[model samples]
Target: MAREGQESPLLKVEGLAISHGDVPITLPLEIVVERGETIAIVGESGSGKSLTARAIVGILPPGINAKGAVTLDGVPLMRLAERELRTIRGSRVSMLMQDPFTMLNPLMRSGDHIDEMLRDRPEFASRAVRADEVKRRLAEVGIVDEDVARRMPFQLSGGMCQRVALAAALARDPELLIADEPSTALDVTTQAEIIKLLRRIQRERNMAVILITHNLRLAFSTCQRIYVLYAGSMLEVGDAAAVERQPFHPYTLGLLLSEPPVDIRVPRLVAIRGSVPRAADVIDSCGFADRCEWAKQICRAGKPSLAARDASRFTACIRQDEIQGELDALRSATLSATPETPRRGGTAGALVHVDALVKTFAGRRGRPICAIRDVSLHIMAGESVGLVGESGSGKTTIGRCLVGLETPTDGDIRINGIAAADFGAMAKADRDRVRRTIQMIFQDPYSTLNPKHSVGQALREALGASAGAPSPAPQERIASLLAEVGLSAAYATRRPASLSGGERQRVAIARALAVKPAILVCDEPVSALDVSVQAQVLNLFRRLQVEHELSYLFITHDLAVVRQIAERIYVLYLGEIVEEGPTERVISNPQHPYTRRLIESIVRSAIQRAP
Candidate 1:
């Protein structure tokens, strides 16, 4: 326990409930954070992690009702008026959102956003002083150049934009800092740097931080205490290390088992079965009972309150003892298994092949930046090949080059024995045919689907523009496409704004499939989605590929996703392919130093519980 001081226990919450349009999305929740302490809220998507944070900040979306006691130094946030809440927003508690691009004003320069946060501060009254402070903050977050700070949000990379946002949020030095999946949008290296920066900031300022995320490893690595939420209810809470070492709840145990082990190669991931229950569903029983292997009749009868499983750990599951034993046996078995090398085997026929691929871009001072260098690989006609790397490792660039968005400076790209250069030199009609064979599904579905158009309209435009010859009626095809992506035909009339994050992604996938392409370029497709939704999407991708014989060039930074679908894996580093082998082998053995580092980092994260 942390020692109490005048400014200790910066924030505390009790029985927080949030509803959307009369539907309760989250159940009663509770959390606490002391000055200079980090509290991590961990759960799968739809687990109500983000909603809990929003409730604390008094920023629940329209039509959402929040009932709770949120206190900051004994001041009741729920009782405060909107006008009063605004004054405390940045000055007392500030938030760094998941996507910096969305949080920032696109029309304004990066420096301006930081300056705006510090506008009322007496020390920043002078323009020159403000500029210097902004630059210093930028530099502290790994952006070393003044020119980079002057650019607009759109002009900067995702990592750079996030750094600028962090600088802006820290400008006020608020008493409480709420970081909602701050590193989700960044690459692995950038994610590490951001975590380190947050730790330093917390230590230096003694600010209470509410870190909300689905990544258990990240939470264990950085937070002092861990609060596991499921269906908007607190499932468990304990010291980070203690809870991870001996997870008391079945949900927490499932989450721990689901994560790929560090030292040994497990045959298959132990995924929790079933999807997260919808917001409209009744929360009468344990939220995790449906998917729990050890669930008993009592678990389904009624919701369970958090009960002490030991001196320090509290769990809400009725079968915690039984599940704990099972989890222990599984962990021991996993740790004892001998690591095996990964092998590749799949469908026949080569769909795409790259030989000595190289891409270079001009840097700020006329220096050359090697984006992809001497990369070689092959993807079968009906296989899903994963490309994994930290940020700036050329994963996105490779995807871009394959989709013809960027012409590679040097390399031979062959699609079905036809060279890309030869295809580029062919007639327009021939080029169009080749282009239709491959399509890309972007990371953010909302951005990919135009807000102005309905789902039906978007599909129609993509089909009409990309498909060579239209044989079927547009309406029928649109309906079929929606059904194929697990959406109802009635959704055709709705715009992207009306859909959930998962629904919008399904629409994006449907739009990509409108042309019936042979291959799909999925770039971080599930990174932005909730875990349960991610599972559904992954299953959908697999089903689609098997049913349609579709090939995939899957690019992502997440190794767990790669292990799920990818048979062969290519590990990139600073635009170079450092390792290439079967997914299991690369992850377990990890021949390359960078790959080893990544694995070690993940292991270290898992072992080091919060605080």
Candidate 2:
């Protein structure tokens, strides 16, 4: 069937707004999608992008009031009853939720998920036909093995779980698909594979897709049009090409420029200065005015109306015409922030060393699963080492074993010339000394922090574990620690639930530094943050390393971040070290095929992008 004329869009949203208990979650917004079009809704975290999506699909949480007009193929979604809306979900529209581990049921096998989705379909009522269709759908998403269908979500890797989620979504056979942060936790190569798979399926089925992600690169490269939102309001909407080349909204421009350019000349990154405002603040005036460099008094007084400049572009800035000059000047200036720091305490000998390390787990039927196999690496004092690999390659397991969370099955780990085995068996004083010497900054900050404790209490507890006489007043030291992490003393009283992801991570770092550790094992610290926040945290790491003379064992799946932070690189594959060398040499001329493919996969992900 041919697409309808532009007179009728496949999915149309007009004046959509959401509120919870008199607080605005999203301002009045408008969106339109033609048949077979893939549109991107891009913004930073807490910008209301996901809230808008939830409202569109009628899945908003309790107490949240959704006021909008949503139409799909001339059917009024907002007007539908609960029973009516539920019927249209899988057959008419399907949503591929973010974080498959949470979205999917852990108790059920992967095959059961597909079966549940297909159960509603008329063609697969028979058991044998449904079983065969399950395998077929899984193969379409790149999971070709039938054995994978029997495994529960907890048994599969992050990338494999994502493919299973995609396969389940496809089984619904909907006319429209909403992929919410589909590639968020995935590594670059795995992310690329998922993106490619989605695009291919979209084209093959000629289905309209709504891609909800904070990644600007994905917005520019994968979608036909982009809608930029800030604090619940639509700031800009335009064709991806025009918007990427010359964005009218200041927030949009800032988001694009915040990404570190691959060019050597642009060594520093200019981060957006402020974070998103509170829900109450967003309801009164322009939510981004305080953060935008070009804001005027009028901008904060009242909200700016979205005005169309042409048939294909719209912007909400009242002074959109004046923003270009400011942006141009910002582009030409050398970055104001120092993104890199010189090696602070580089020593002749290694600070932490591993020799023939191995970690194995007992699998089903008592089979041994080797997570780490004879991996040996070292980091010098004040030097940063990158441990890069796909999921299940043991990058995190190494960090755990080095930190003594896991006992090494074989080989040795030496921290400051003390063997891990000896350290574990040492006297109480010696163990305390080792704990102070080496500490870990976990990947998820909230999980590491206690919900019952305030930030001040957390810091104070670190001080209480003192290796010396207590300071005169712990409050002064707590304030100092907060300041060192770029947070104010006010943050000390705030609990973990009140802080943002970036703020929580900073607190995690401050707590680690409170013990004055000689070395920090940072495990994907910035992976959970937004792009702008990620830059800020990375810059903070460099500055702290210089100030405290610290060494870091940085484990991450993002090769780009590893390239920026690590001096040396180790590429792991299937629990074995496949490649190891200086960061530059390893990235440019990788020796192993796995390393080379990892590099190429990232490059190929940008198959289409705005110049």
Candidate 3:
């Protein structure tokens, strides 16, 4: 399918299928990557994005098998032996995983990791030369700190660890790089820097790249082409700009609409209804039929084929043309709609107050590291206050201090007119009374919930520990709590591992609500979720706020998400509050330089995608 005078693709995937044991996980798929080109494979979690990448690299777990043809530079990889594949893995094609901290060896130094990759190469004839190359590679990835070479993985920051990982991946100067969710763990500013560095390296080396991610907007910003996948099937493929401007498949359009725009604020984000179907449940029909609003009976009659819409576009939907028209109308209606005016709250006295709060930790060689300075803030009853900052900016530290996870070094914290310091000194009943009034929801809900307990058991345990007077039976109360978070009572029988990311978060919220807390401290609750799932959770938060009249301390690095949920915003940098004001005012006219820099890193592709 090459044009005249064009070279064959650097990588070609034809009729590629993956299976575990006897059950097939992915259908036959095709992908092509030209030399020096960047393409994106985008979808939500469990869409086979990661599995496909693993299959291509011959790294699937035991019992999983990959079939069909995959070629790099006209060399077939399907029939290659394990020893042969090892020879081609790092020298010709390299991969970077999602979490660098976990991927890297904690015992080894940063420079040592890269040195090991180059140890087998003949180009570096001496240790001195290899040492110099290690520094050069680190500098190539924007890590200029010479001391990073000697420090362990835990000693480095998240950004620095990721840069080291990138340096190691490029040790052999591979022809192709596979970066899987590269920036999902870093803050906004660090993510932008990493992506910029990646593009620069790809261009300098003329290497091809396959970016796999759950974020469509992120993929569009860095890639020339995008392939949208859903329920283990490829749904759409097109030029990045073409897909952004006019996505053909209903699922693709839904993904585009789910993204929260940084340039403008909306009353509610457009969410795709329903969760992705489980792999076992996917039938020989449209994978998105359950969630597609315009689906007809024909959609479920048989599986649709990927048909060409134009020279550069293909979609797996029989109703693409019809759905495109409906999408255009919806965009028009959204553009013409009046913006909703948000109500300002916090007229009552402060329900939670911290004065001269300070927290410090022991650093290397016993030096003191101040996590938070003499920072002070308050939240009034029934108000949502956002705490915005980068990873090491002390946002999580403050949240922990507020919820009794960590005792403050120096400060005064009062909850509902009671001194937080007196909690330990008070009677067990009194301490429970004050603690039950406030609850904290962590970033990973699965980690917080006990995996062995069913959802009903978890909720029952929480209800049993309540200090307040009980009025309902345990089962009845559990059902009510689940329903409050938009979940059915049947979910109570399922364990945490059986639920999706969004579903687990909903269960976590229900558990937090079991004690009838007046305030909730949510810490980056939706950062790792898909856009559609994130919107659903955000909407659930809004509804819960109104129904329970609960105050919220929403902490996140995403400005768009904060603007949607928080009434007032506090921008934190280096353990200090740089700016604080109404969400609109602060985001529109940031006074602090740090706040402005944070805003600049936000990707505004959602607004730019439309006219």
Candidate 4:
């Protein structure tokens, strides 16, 4: 831990450059971490935030070459050999990786990993002391049980695994902690718990923290200062509160506008059009010039240097002053850009109906766990219905059951005037009809998409049996599907792993549309997406629903998202529908206590505190 009243900053990074062969990933970056202060390196995906962290920790990939001067308390980390770096890794400085599930050892028990982190410390010399410390750390992070400690990473929920990862990282009491997208995959409430725990632990230990995330909300919630990165370059840096009020850079402002707000009447989110430029595609001009609406000839001719804008604030935009002057006017234009009104569900007959759906899974010791208990809901033709609750409240289960992924213990599911159970039992030709009209879009696109299959191949597989006699041919079908989901036809040959998260999700949506489903069952579709991408995907979903006249059974834990997309909402608690009403009525005046708590859990991106 950093000593209180120590003179110099906890860490310093200067003249940092990272490159893979001739391609530059990051250019001449500079950052300073004061003792016990939290700083956020915020950006969208592919902004080189993780690459910066990897360079600091001396784990740059084999093909990558890093040229930087990174010092921790006057000691140069770049000069250190591998063995020396390893010694300093967990003791003086440590890293908590982005995906906790992948970072943790699936073979080892949770407590074992925590104990191993402190194995080299003299303070934890004995086994008994180490065991006690393990329990204490686990409890500190809200995983307070001997049984929990013994469980493997696969046995724990995403939230619990994240807590275990945190416990392990703090085990050695490192002076600097680098958390890379710490709570990315967790739900809102679990994310809140992790956020509070991180703040408390940082205060208790007086340790400096470097939080790397694409999440602006999480960044504002924790960091004292924010450095916004764009396409491997630092675009803006300022006090969190100051930047929140007035962002100097157009990219930063666009990012803020892209955020999904809890309270706003904006027609649609202001998306920064175009994708993140690849490192190899670097040009002499500003990296964001192509996407920025205010870009002029000068912005497209030369790169801007990081210059002072105001007190303790700097931005790398040549027209920062001009943009700052018209912030309100530009924002008003974005908010005033009207979206096509979502056609509400008229007094039409129900297209998909569920009556007292009950699903029970085999539990420990032969006890049945009721995942769905008398939960009843319906989606009208050309309408959208949402099911929202906490992570384990059976939202996904209900979705799976409705789409025929899971067999309900007892219930009546009617889709397009036909009994869903009977359709499942129908002959081959009849079963194909159900599959073509009622499709499911899963939560994790990475896992749902086949790694071995190209985008075209994945689409062709989905179109099987349904595309009888191949009216459009597989290639034509693939091209049309890609275009429908806002991707270029050239993306057909690209593999899932090569695509960005948003692009992969678009592919997932395309695959679902291959069979031309009339109703979509989307499970937590945008929960794990970056805010900007979430806005884009949400907007895309709205457009697709309108074009296809699609009915939706959207299951998610995000109240804000559901409020925007769903016409009617059902709040699930312990596998039961605790509250049901129109989206506006439920959000404005939530009736049930559980439903109110869920609504309250909707965290705002920015929080203002007393100066």
Model 4 residue pairs with clashes:
none
Q: Which ten residues in a row have the lowest lDDT in candidate 1?
A: 602-611
Question: Clash pairs of candidate 1?
Answer: 223-610, 223-611, 224-611, 240-610, 342-585
Better of 1 and 3 by TM-score: 3
Worst 10 residues of 2 by lDDT: 602-611
The candidates, ranked best first by lDDT, are: 3, 4, 2, 1
Runs in model 4 with CA error above 4 Å? 1-6, 333-342, 467-477, 606-611
Model 1 lDDT at residue 521: 90
Q: Rate the local accuracy (lDDT) of all candidates.
A: 0.81, 0.83, 0.88, 0.84
Taking the tens digit of each residue's C-alpha lDDT, what string does model 2 give over 1-611? 11235568889898898998888788778898888999999988998888888888899989998897999999999999999999888788888887888767999999999999888667888988999999999989988889999999998988899999988877878889999999988887888888889999999999999999887877777899999988888889888888877778888877776664432213555578769886568676778888888888989888788888877889988888877777755654533333343343475788788999988899889999999999999989888888998877899999988888888889888888777744567678767877888999998999999999999999999998868765658899999999999999999999999999999999999999988998999999998888888878887887888788889999987776787777788999989999998777787778899988787666321312222
lDDT (Cα, tens digit) per residue for candidate 1, span 211-273: 998887788888879999887788898889888787777777667666544444444555666
Q: Which candidate is the best by TM-score?
A: 3
When summed lDDT is taken over every stretch of 10 residues in candidate 4, the lowest stretch is 602-611
lDDT of 2 at 575: 90
Q: What global local distance difference test value does model 1 have? A: 0.81
Candidate 2 stretches greater than 4 Å from native: 1-7, 261-267, 332-345, 469-472, 603-611
Models sorted by TM-score, best on top: 3, 2, 4, 1
